[model samples]
Target: MSFRSEPFLWIHLAGLAVLPLFLELTWLGLAIAESLVPVWLELILLAIVGIVPIAWMQWQKPFDIFSLLFVALQPQQLTSQQRQILRLFKTRKHRVLTLFAVLAMGWALWKLAVFAPLAAPAAARLTQSRGLGLGLAIVGFLGSNLFLQVPISVLGVLLTSNGQFEVTEPLTPEEVSQSVTVLGFRVGNILPTVASNNL
Candidate 1:
């Protein structure tokens, strides 16, 4: 079901939206708090944000967001040259995922630096804030979004275009499905759980 189609999905999304807001409020409180607060508490809150969504996906695999993202990918039409490009990317998925993982770790470091002050407060929460244990949170945001679209879009482009080369051929539905299936592997290699069926 679409996010707007059903009340439950909407309700679930709306409810989940509050979580980040709560996290933001806590960060704000940390930034402005006068006394040293428990660092573990901040860690736990970040953990909850990461766990809840994945848990939701685990608990409701078919209806989760990944399924929604790939729903329209089945009619994946591609030219013969485009298919060649797809094969090229598929051949080196390990390298691609490695790159993504490295970038993700770099992002984690960025978050730590950004939240450092809150991790160890020196003044009031409003005046000072930071985090010592925010790695999982960095994983949740970047890993999820990065895998969700950036990689998919890259593959999608190759699927629909001949790159600098141009093509002129009438496409068939079966050919399209085959090309889309190839793309599933492209993204699947990066994240098996997210692209399991596509693989």
Candidate 2:
């Protein structure tokens, strides 16, 4: 991977490793607040938090997001056609959409906490700490978005592109020096060898 793409690789991998933990924490929080708020409603809020930011990112920078998953050449290295393709991803809109999405997520968490004040459940000592539960839920949601959402959003863009974007194979050193590759992977296979070769 290029220097620019390396950090994103780490974020994506870390997110994959911790995704289960976050999911469990979120569920535990919901369980604690089951009496105060419907689990389904909380779940819907979580979905909105998770999805809106990604949608905004897609709208703001479609091809730019692909750099998070694949090793893409620098903007200067791209051909006019390639740059034009990427340029299409850019939008004239301001950053307000992304900001609003983040604020909305924070608001949802705040609402959850306010509706279900943190107090120890009278019934079970260990299983019923509303405060701890809400805290965990908040952490899980934030962590999920912070670490995993970019990579997931990139995948979403790629899948929906319907082959509009080009992703080449790992470029040999010789080819790298002489050619301009759009998007490629530095290590490992995005698809099986046979599948890639067939393509």
Q: Rate the local accuracy (lDDT) of all candidates.
A: 0.36, 0.45
Off by over 4 Å in 1: 1-70, 93-97, 103-107, 110-114, 118-199
Candidate 2 local lDDT, 136-180, one digit each (tens): 676677555544544443333333242443332233434333333
- Report the backbone clash tally of model 1: 15
Worst 10 residues of 1 by lDDT: 1-10
Clashes of each: 15, 0
lDDT of 1 by residue, 1-199 (tens): 1112322223223343444443443334343433345655654454455434433332222121222333332234332433333333322442353345445534543454357566445324233323422433435443343333233334333344343224334335464444333212212222344334322
lDDT of 1 at 110: 43
Q: Could you tell me how far off, in angstroms, the CA of residue 114 lies in candidate 1 after the best superposition?
A: 6.3
Off by over 4 Å in 2: 1-14, 61-127, 154-199
